[model samples]
Each structure stands twice: as C-alpha cells, then as structure tokens.
Target: MESQVTNNANALRLFFTDDVFVVEDKSVQIVLPAVTEAVSATVSIPKVEAKEAVVVVENTVIPAEKPLPPSESYAQKGEILPIVEEPLQPKAFKFLGGNKKSVLILVNDAAYDVSTEQGRELLRKIVKAVDLATPDFALLNYANYKGTTYAELHQFFKPQIMLSFGVEASHLQLNLNWAGEIIVHETTRIIFAPNLHPLDSDLSAKKSLWGNLQKIK
Candidate 1:
C-alpha cells in the first residue's frame, strides 16, 4: 500500500515538471481538388487527323481486252460455258467468300440474289472466269455504291479488279461502253459485263463475257 502511494506521488511530480513532454490539441487541415479540376488534370483524349486532299482523276481508259491467245483452248469450245465438270443439281448453291482485292465489286442494278439457283449459276461462271474462288470476291449494287467516289474506293479496297454487271450499274458512275465491253472509267481497271437479263440464255454472250474476264489476271 505504501509503495503504491510513492509511485503515485512520483507520477504527479513528473506531470508538473517542465522537462516532461506535453501534447497540444491542434486541428489539422486537408485540401481536396474540385471535380472539374480533377477531371481536366487526369483525363486526356486524342483528336483524329483530317483526311488528305481528294484526287481528281481524269477519265483514263483502261487497255482494251485482247483476243484470246493460242494457249487458252477454252475459247474455241462450244459457246456453252459450263461452270462445273459434272451435272449441277438444283439444290442450294453458294459460290461467294474469299480474300479481298480479287474483286472490289460486282455491281448490278438487276438486284439478282446470288442465293437463288439462276444467280448462283451466273456467279459460278463469273468467279471461274476470274480464276478465283467465290469466297475471294465482293458484290455491290450501283444504287448502293453511288455516293463514294472512285478515288476513295480505290484507296480503301485497292481492288485488283472491278466487275460491273448490267448497263445501269456500269453507267451509274463509270463511263463504260454499254455493249458489255471491259473498260476502265478512270485509273481503276473494270470489267463492264452485260446486263443479267439477256445473259441468262445467251451462251454466246456468256462465252464473250467469260473471254473478257480472262484478261484481268
């Protein structure tokens, strides 16, 4: 009991002594950034660069299709151009899907759905004539692609060749010979094919069209 009293007295003395440490109740201040200031400081967005000046392409005619040379014996064969080796049945047939540039387009005004039997047949011949599989091609309608200029199209698709089917499709923008002649409207090389209406039964037209397609590549 006496020792407890002594310890208490010692603690009291220490508290009163000037050498002992003392703590003050001082308030601390904290600063926070405003929402707008935080956002401006933290976030950054990039701007898109403007497009280059447009190219004014004067109408330059593509080289005319030459007569079929000696090696291609398919020219002399009967005007009937058969797509497949064996007989083709009427079941669902699809011949499209391939790498780009093989055909930037196969524009037509007829709106012939290639999903149908007759359309499939024509597409087969067209694909075969180019010596490319159906997958490696693209099809367009004149009505749809009228807005984009030829130079923009060339810059984007950079097609190795362009094939236009039917008169309206060819004449829409491309100044081509309407007689199913393969011609160039400008710097781009194009194949101006006959309208699908007459080409359905006309084997001679198919032969001639197929003959012209061989010139591409």
Candidate 2:
C-alpha cells in the first residue's frame, strides 16, 4: 500500500512543476520521458576452435655427490716429502721376554696388567702346549697391533709363527698373503685360534690352539 502511495506521489510530481502554487485553480502540465535515437554500428567477433594437446615430461638423471679425494701440490725444488713409513705400533702388553723372536702370540686382551702374575699364568699355559727346544716366547696384545700393517709386523716381530687368539685371528690376516686359516707369509706362519677369555676354565679352547700349534711347529 505504501509502494502504491509513493508511485502516485511520483506521478503527481511529473504533472505539477515546483513553480505551481497550492490552489484549487492551479494548472498542471504532463511531462513525458524523452527517448534518444538508437545507435547502430558494425561489431566483428573472431571464432576460436578448442583442441586436445599432449604434454610429455622426460626424467632427468642427477648424479650422486662424491667427496673429493685429498690432493697435495708437488715439491718446488730441494725440499722433499719425508717418506711415510708404518707408524710405530706400541705394545699393549710389553714383550714377555726382551727380544722379538720365534713364536709371537697375539692375545685378544689381558686379565690384568700383562706384566702381573695373572698375565704370566695365561702365557705359561699356551707356552707349555708348544713343543720347542727354547720356544723363545714373545707376546703382543692384538689391540696394540691394529694400526701396524702385517708387513711392518713381520719386519718388527719377525716371528717364525704368529698365533692369534680371539677376534684377532681374522685381524692378523690383514695385509698378508694367505690361503685360508693358515698363513705362510715368507718365514712367518700365522695360526688363527678361538678366543680364550676364560683361558684356564675352557680346556677345549686350549686343546684347539695346542692342536693347531703342533701342526705348524
């Protein structure tokens, strides 16, 4: 109803101008909305065709990053690069007897300081098993010999036979010419033996070492 009243008010505004006086005899003139002439011109739109497309992505191979090897520049003139010899491998346990000789026993570890009574006792058992006129026993803990090469070991100890105990059995084989368990590298004979942790208790380990020791000696 309000919308109809508003529409009628707007219609009356078109009939009576703002200049007309509020009187019963007042005149009203009707004014119609003017329409402009229609504008006509040419508009051209281009046609586009939709089509399918194939996209192929080739796999690129990326090479692994490698560490660069250490490089040294050449010597200029008189100066010389001091020759690098096998580093001195310290004895974990000192030589039982002074000189490096015939039978070098490579022990896995020691019960105590190898110089002690317990160490000597451990040695006495193995030394007794071998049959030799003098025996001239020498002992080295394998832990001491890790850094030393077999070649340097051969040169230093210069043993006729190398008896390795525990994990050192396979370790002593490094840098040495060998067939299997038994290794005959020039003069030195290497015999790999089972671990002797509970040395005195395990009779079989002692017997195994003693048995193989007999073959080489």
Candidate 3:
C-alpha cells in the first residue's frame, strides 16, 4: 500500500511539473477475423471465331468438269512454268430444219435438249401450226449464238421471213423501235412472238401468233 501510494504521488508530480517527456517504442498488433477457406467466384468468357461471308448469284454457269493435273511442284530453281492458252471456240450456227423457202425460225432455249424425240415432236407440231414443214424453215437456237446480228443472219440463211420466239430484235442487234409488231426490215419480214413451248397450251397466244403469222409474207 505504501509503495502504490508513493508511485501515484510521483506520477502526479511528473504530470503537474514541467518535466522532459519520453515515449516508449512498441510494435502494434492488429486483431483480424479467424482465417477461413475462400469461396471461388471465377467468371468464364467464351471465345468467338470469325466466319466467311456468303454470296448469291443468278444465271450462274458452272464451268465444264475436267480431270485434275499431276500435283508436281512447278517452282524449280532455274526453270520456268509453262504458260497455257485456252483454244478459241468456233462460232457456228447449228440449225435443226433446212432453209428451203428462205424462212428463219429463231428460238432462245440453248439449255433445252432439242435432240430428244419429244423435242422433235413438239417442233413438228409448231411448224405444222405455222402452216410450214420441217424443211421449209430453218430452226435456229439463237441462244447458242447470243450476239448474232441481223446482217450475219441474213448473210447466213438469206431469209426473206424471220420468226423470233422468246428473242428480242435488240438481241439480234436490230434497232427496230420504229417497226410495228410485224417488222419489214429491207426484204426480211420479221415477227417477234412468245416461246413455242407455251403456245402449245395457251389458246389466246396461239390465236394471236396464228393471226400474226398470216401477216408475215
């Protein structure tokens, strides 16, 4: 009790008196929460890949099928690759019927197989309807010869009467804006009509074509 009271009296004296103060050096200890197992919160992001754009084409013609050449390395040292040139295709107008009366019948269906029996039968009917025979007029598929001119046709067939089916005068390089339904260019009497295939079933078209046919020559 005596020592306690004495120590308290010294402390009070030091506080009251203008004495030199001293600070004690000590390390600070922080009390944190108890260590626990961490919960996983990993977010996964999916990888995106790029794709090629698609294109659409109309009246697309697939190239002719040919066998692939030998896979030899053409890149040789001190050697040159051979330059290949495609052969020029011949432009001959192949017709079905004989042009006996200097009459021309033009069709625009090259894809259509005219060599078949059905095709021949249909052609026979068409010619008969026009009051002509197979040998009387030249049946030319002008679609095969796309850019044929009036002068070229005239020189080739020497036609006095031309009946165009599913083909325009502009296609034959004829500027016949002034000409009526039945055109009289030079000596050739031209009549532009619908395709022959449709005329077989279309009564109205057949009547109209028949009427127009009489007007030409």
RMSD vs true structure, all candidates:
39.4, 23.7, 31.2
Overall lDDT per candidate, in order of appearance: 0.59, 0.62, 0.74
lDDT of 3: 0.74
Q: What total of clashing residue pairs does each candidate reach?
A: 4, 0, 0
* Pairwise TM-score winner, candidates 1 and 3: 3
Error of 2 at 19 (Å): 99
Which candidate has the highest lDDT of all? 3
Q: Candidate 1: TM-score?
A: 0.44
Could you tell me which 10 consecutive residues in candidate 1 have the lowest summed lDDT? 87-96
Cα lDDT tens digits for candidate 2, 1-217: 3454445777888867869566664366657688876877667676676666767788888888898885756875688989888766644435565433567766666444343455457566666666532337666766554655565566677788877665353464476533335767677777765544555557766666566767875
**Alpha-carbon deviation at 107 in model 3, angstroms:** 0.6
Best by TM-score: 3
Better model by lDDT: candidate 1 vs candidate 3: 3
Model 2: lDDT of residue 177: 36
The lDDT of model 1 is 0.59
Candidate 3 residue runs with Cα over 4 Å from true position: 1-91, 115-122, 178-180
Per residue, candidate 3 scores C-alpha lDDT tens digits across 1-217 of 4564545776788667776678664675667889997978887877777667766658878999898996877677779878897643444678977889889988777667442454456567657766787788888887788787877888788899888777787888888862336778999888876666654567776666677766753
Where is model 1 more than 4 Å wrong at Cα? Answer: 1-98, 109-112, 146-149, 167-170, 178-180, 185-187
* Candidate 1 C-alpha error for residue 173, in Å: 2.4
Cα lDDT tens digits for candidate 1, 27-131: 755556655644446555677889898999899999999987669666566777666666323322122355355575544443554334665577676777667
Instruction: Report the error of model 1 at residue 84, Å.
Output: 53
